[model samples]
Target: MEKTKYSLGYRNSYVLQQYRCLLSIFTGFIILLFISNTAFALATNPGAVCSNGFSQGSLTNADYTNLVSAVNTNNYVNILGNAGGSIPLQVKMTTVESSTNTVKSNFGVITTAGTSAINIQRTFPNISAYTDIIFDFRNALTSQPIYLTNVALSAFDIDYANSNGNTFDDFVEITGVTQAGSTISGTLQPITGSNIVFGQPPQGLQGLFTRTASDPNCTAKNLGTQCQGSVQFSQPVASVKVRYTNTGYLNSATNQEIDLRVDNYCYVPQYIFTGTVFDDNGGITAAQANATNDDITSSGSIYTNKPNYFNGVFNSPQESGISGSTVKLVNCANTATTYATQIVNTGSPIGQYQFSVPIATFNNNTNICLIEEYSGTAYPIRTTSDNKNTGFTTTTYLYSNNDFGRVIAANAALVLKKAQYINNCPNTLNYTDPSLNTANNGDPKTGFSTGSISNMTPGQCIAYRITATNRANIGINNFVMKDILQKQGVNGATVTSVLTNPPLSTTDYTISENPAIGVNGEIKTKSLTLTSRSKRDFYFNTKYGTTVDTQ
Candidate 1:
């Protein structure tokens, strides 16, 4: 029972607080884990990152051969070289001695090594796989200097073996040099060799080489002269075709062989995405934009007049209420025939406008326009009489349900109907027609335009309230409906008096004539229950511009 006191040290308290914080964090993390497990899962799509089939990198000579094999049956590669120029330019592992390999001094590899006997060397890392191969070279002798002539490229399965067994058969000889040189080098090295073994003479490995007898300095012979032996090493190739000159050379003074190398090649697919364009006109059926030789081509509709954006499709004002409108997706650039055509129906909903058009149709250079067919002669007419109406002269009148009030009621209904779209949905949306406003001279008119809302969400409670007042005069019976003649033209022209019926909803608020412009000149205030049905009808009217305006 003695007084016992316990003192907590500052250091101990700090440590204890840290431990408590850690424990609380650990508990919170565990709770978070449980919540996450219950939630939806999301991961990046694999195709979104890597969609190509082959890994991208430079291929070796052997690897290149494999690629050629892969694409052999398909003819995927496009070769660019002379008629006999495109042979495998890969290094041969076997060594060639001076005796086994023939070398002409004037035509052979004038190696910087400068040895009497040149041993052809085959470098390692031999193969360079490519879609195809190209070959380009220059002669060792010419009247002016060294230049290429009678250029041709040949493709074969073997890199070093020539049809004649002597690689010289693959030689594309040039005949316009005056040098007294001898010996031709026929070394086939992928990294660096000149000799290409093109088999067989009838196989047409050698393109014709010519020379003019007039030029004394041009002593180069057609077959041999300074013709360096061909170098034939091969990398794997998807294709082996020769791109050669069928015409003249320096001797002809009109053409000359090109100096080049099978520097690089590529193998790419034809098309990436496929889809179509839909006919979204007010009435007609839609068509698709499809792929044509790696490109998107579309055949569809044309805009004869201004376009109308109703719901999701592009419609025409002229064809808005017209039945059996025709539409198709066509390539605007092509003077070609249309692909598909469909009949469009009048008053069709937005979502039902187009069918079967793929998403890729939007990517093409297709133009979407509305071709409207004129339906009727009696079009909408405009008027100029301050279209608003007023009751007879009276000082203080009880306000009756008039055209203006009815218009306001209609608007209120629309507010309810479009509430969901304004609050939650982001994309453009449309609604059906609402019941006509019957109050006084008010006529229901439908319209389409962008809309927005505030203080509500889709599936939430909505209400409509209206208040009407006469600021100038009061104390008389101001009715809501009236049949008054209005001149819709200049001056007091022709007048058409029409009686307006009240709106459909009986649920409404009416404020009798009041003494107050209340606060801010507001004479009366009416509040009505805005039910879900009212909202739907109201939104419908808004789309068609039928909703009337009130006070």
Candidate 2:
């Protein structure tokens, strides 16, 4: 019996251990699954993945063959249809070394002869849309060559209409290069004393280039040596030029030429929208005041309290930008379909905001709108500019100065008055005293008189009237008014009932007891639109007490 019990106990313990192990494994798997899903969600988000819209050149074997044929026939060919075919690659072999330079089909590679200087030009259909150009190059020749000298890359924009007026003065140079997971660093120096122009007549600007022999990738003369680098332009350029002034062999007797192969060309396209949110505190003009009638008081007097409020104009120098405001880019037709959103910058150049969208996100002529949300704490009593909600069609690559303005609204005018009934209350029966009028002298049974009353007995009843008025031209919304009853004498005064003169509409206003202050306080709230420049009166009656009360 003891041996059987021990065996059963051991089996139960083993089962429990297995169950715990399975639970731990299942829990780990669930955690991993959640982590992977979160990462995928972030990666697929448009705002996270499409900032610059970098795309590589994807060319097929047929495309490469066509590129080679076009280069041989016309010395130029437009490859790769990327960015909705807006940016096409046009490669031209301007000065080719006939003896050794060969444009091959493999990866559409260009192998150049090192005997004489070579010039290659790459043009784009829309240069302005591209921000950076990247490509890979290598020296495939086995024999070492005298370091490539005066190796320059230039970028410039050309005007086809004016044959003699091309702009080549803009600086375009190789910014950085990467080789074997390392950076080849060098400083860009001006290519002076060289009369070499990139394209045809009318060169717009001179190009800049850099050279460094200390980098192994550039100095290596081994076969299959490679280096990846990028070219950046100070301004948009129509074409880029790669020139190798001297490619002489290291051993003059060998007659072995340096084979330079260039491939893997890519470009990053950037479409940015920039704007500012500013306070247009230009102030209200005399014409505006006359039209809106906001400068007049209730008593027929000229109201000049706020001279600089709303002027319906933007003053750039005098007025400053409003920071910490949210701005959104949405479809004009359906604003709920938001494309991007940004907050107004709070640092230097305050109130500036920018949004960058992916390539082909919005085609030309697409209706879009930039909406700025108002901040009550930042700009209290202010109204947005007329064009704040305006929409415009997408047309340009760089949209700038699409500003939103805010101006102070008209002055707020409010008035409040309280009055007590002075005359005696009417009584048909249960009269406290005979001095009171039985026919209701000044006070009516339905309403109370707007006069102060004094020297009344403890048992005498009295009524109070409160009036509120909004004199502003603009309507107010959700306006709340609170009245707290005070304790008088020993037993204190108790409010019997409350009433409004015009009868409060359920849609326009609401009346309720203040829960925070108990039943002693009453609150009235008014909605917007129905009561513009309106007045309201509230009446409540209370009986005088004889005993003393603390509160």
Candidate 3:
């Protein structure tokens, strides 16, 4: 879409003179930004094509004599097109004078050997559609991106299926001679009836598969969205045109360069026989992918609320596509290896992957947990403990890499607001998170409030109101909430008594006091018991009197 610019004429000599210079610079800047953001390109535009529309090259004037001789010498016609047990081997052949689609190179090649075969090498200006397609692939796997180019602009008809009987398309149809050199343009008919092609519907197929935006049979195994391929032409000159394609994920390709060597060209297909030789069986594990380009940065005034997904990204180094994996969201404070889970599927562009949570699992401010969003083959994840270290509060999205790669993960601050309510210390020593709410009901939320473990004086029978929660989407098992007392440190707050297991993932703990409460007071791992499977709560009182008090 073209942006509209308004012209302002002050008609006041003073004001007009003052802002004219500034207006000129501002206009130029706006034009530059518009061009950069839009990245208008002709290669991806469907309207710039010629009369015949991008065509599929066909074989014209087929000389059966040479082909018959080659077939007799080979004798390998036992496989393809085996409809009625056998095909008439000696059938007469005719010439159809197939379209002479000539390619004119855009990346600067004047000619091709003696016969005109364009060797693909180097980068064409990127189609913004390619980047757009990349993002689409990311979000599609996680949910569902463009690269733009102008090579097909006024030169190669973006819509041309025919040329003065010489329209250009995707088929590498070579003519004007034998396989060795050029001569008179040969006329061989497109393979029909008994002739078989890999990607055709077979109903009315009299030729090769012509790539288009709507061709259902357009497919290239292992490429992006296999069946969505489309032919793209880059012809800046008249004599030679180069056509690769939109591999069919909306854009053609980024820089996945392909170089076809002359002597080593081994993928030439022969009619009458076809079979798979090497099938890709392995997956593009996250450890094998490049760093994913998806970021989870806080993007707008309000975060996305649709099935609020916590997207995780990872990279893969291999190219075989991806597989599904699992991530465990475990509570940071729980001593037990308790956690909930979310399934992360393999991404759309093959190697990239996206992980998401329904955004409805977090309950309260006490909901602080740590888990790796990346749940594929390990790139060696890098993350800190979930609120495990001393004085640590911020919930971190673990970003791990197998070999020093990076990925952006959507990390929300898991609110574990802890503050001592009782005025047991100096006024300046007390603190509470001002943003925490008074309560929570465990729906989908962003911020929450949770009271803390506070300071106490010697023999200051302090009542510890502990309400902890694991706010992430996953759940954990057998969480432990421990507290202890020592002689030298600030008097420890004893677990005064048992109350409701508020959060649930923190319940059913066997509250046993060390030495039976004051025979040298210490608590033996106030851990949850066997029955409590997914309790996410913590509640107990404490009498402060010892030098060393901790949880």
Candidate 4:
């Protein structure tokens, strides 16, 4: 008998093992770039702070100095320099030279790539067929330098055509493209393209791209089994518009364009993972975050007062990490926003990330952050028997569920509640009524800040309380609640007694007083069962500053 062995790989987050397979992708502009992408990575910074460009290389002190300067000035520059510059670098060339049978002007084989940096802006088409849409420049490769910025794509035109009825006016967008020698860089986007031909039902050709080798439906067509290939745009795109500028040169003698190619690739769309911010203070709303062209351009920086950190790993079919790796955030339903970063911590979980969100602009001071590790690209739209060039469709989209792999930042989810206390004032001779629950004391909405000054008196009973609420639908097992009272002001209060409004019972839950502290001074945790949507309140008493000195 022969021995057999097998190996497996994971494509989500929160596991120790998967961190070993580090990938590098580098898409020019756009979050969710991956390994292959890093092959042509380039960063460009415009400000004096931070270096203007970077790739698979080291950062100079100048880069750090610039980055630090930008941070200090509240001016967050790209630092990556992958973003666009002063103007849109433009070029005008055709995918192919005009042949005798095909009239150059009428056929619309291609528009002379625009010459001079035309500030002409084009809208991004909404194509939901494929997530990793690659901008394929098939048969358009040349030796001339290719430069692009602010690529604009239109919607698919099924029945529409240019001056000639032969050429369909389908929109194809490949934004933020750059070329260095044989290396190509930019965003691979899925635009409404000329996939559909005339005399064809709109719905008929929509699913044509889905017949790829990766598609289970494509395993067999008619009666035989045939696996085809397809393309996808990497990661969840922040914008379809390209971000950069450059000058393009054409073939000298022919003056024809050079270094032109539209070849890209896409995957089944499982390149991202998620982690929560414990209590994130996100400001963008879901409607606004998810809306098309509805970008929220708020002033202020993203890294101020952000004390939260989250950790997770990413998995891709090939590799991912360079540009376009973004994490989407939602404050439950209150606000949503996206922060794009390069994939760090490829080799270890120790490289956990920190997302600094300013507390001032944070909506819903408390929030749940959604994390997704995105890595993808877009490729040619095709209807072929082999996996090569099988443009994908929505009907055949593959879905994977990774709910358990969610991530949350450290030092998040701090909760505090108030407990009523009957009180009297210090120096009763001239004391006024004990104003409880006042702005000076504690507001019901914002919780307690400063304790009641009038209520401060020796031997007066004060209740320090805590309220726990279970938000999940399912019951929690072995719920542990631990808290250490803070040292208030100069002298502060000291815990004198601990008691439950209703004493704890073993039948349902348990509570311990003065739980033992570990060698590291960490307090022991309390364990109990908490029912779904249930609430519990605990009360204890404390003595105010006993030693008073002249102020």
The runs of at least 3 residues in candidate 2 whose Cα sits more than 4 Å from the true structure, single-residue gaps closed, are 1-319, 330-339, 347-349, 354-382, 385-392, 395-474, 477-497, 500-551
Candidate 2 structure quality by residue, lDDT tens digits, 190-218 = 22322222221122222231122222222
Provide backbone clash counts, one per model.
105, 15, 94, 75
- The CA lDDT at 486 in model 4 is 34
lDDT per model vs. reference: 0.23, 0.40, 0.26, 0.26
Give the winner by lDDT: 2
Better of 2 and 4 by lDDT: 2
Give the per-residue lDDT of model 4 (tens digit) for 502-536.
23333323334442211011122356766643556
TM accuracy, model 1: 0.21
After the best TM-score superposition of candidate 1, give how far the Cα of residue 114 lies from its true spot, in angstroms: 30
- 2 or 3, greater by TM-score: 2
CA RMSD of each candidate after superposition = 32.1, 24.8, 28.0, 28.8
lDDT of 4: 0.26
Off by over 4 Å in 4: 1-414, 423-458, 468-479, 484-509, 512-525, 528-536, 541-551
Best by TM-score: 2
Tens digit of per-residue lDDT, candidate 1, span 1-551: 12222244656778899999999999999998765433212111111111233111222333334333433243222222221221212211111122322221221111111211111122111111001122222111111111121121211111122123222111132212112332221222221121223232332434322122121221112111122222321222222223222122111111112211222222211111111112222232223211111111123322112122112222333223323334443444442434344454445431122322322443444343222222223321111111122221222112121110011111111111112222122122223323222222121121222233333332222111121221111111222321112222425533221111122133221323322111111222234332221121322101111112221
TM-score of each: 0.21, 0.34, 0.25, 0.25
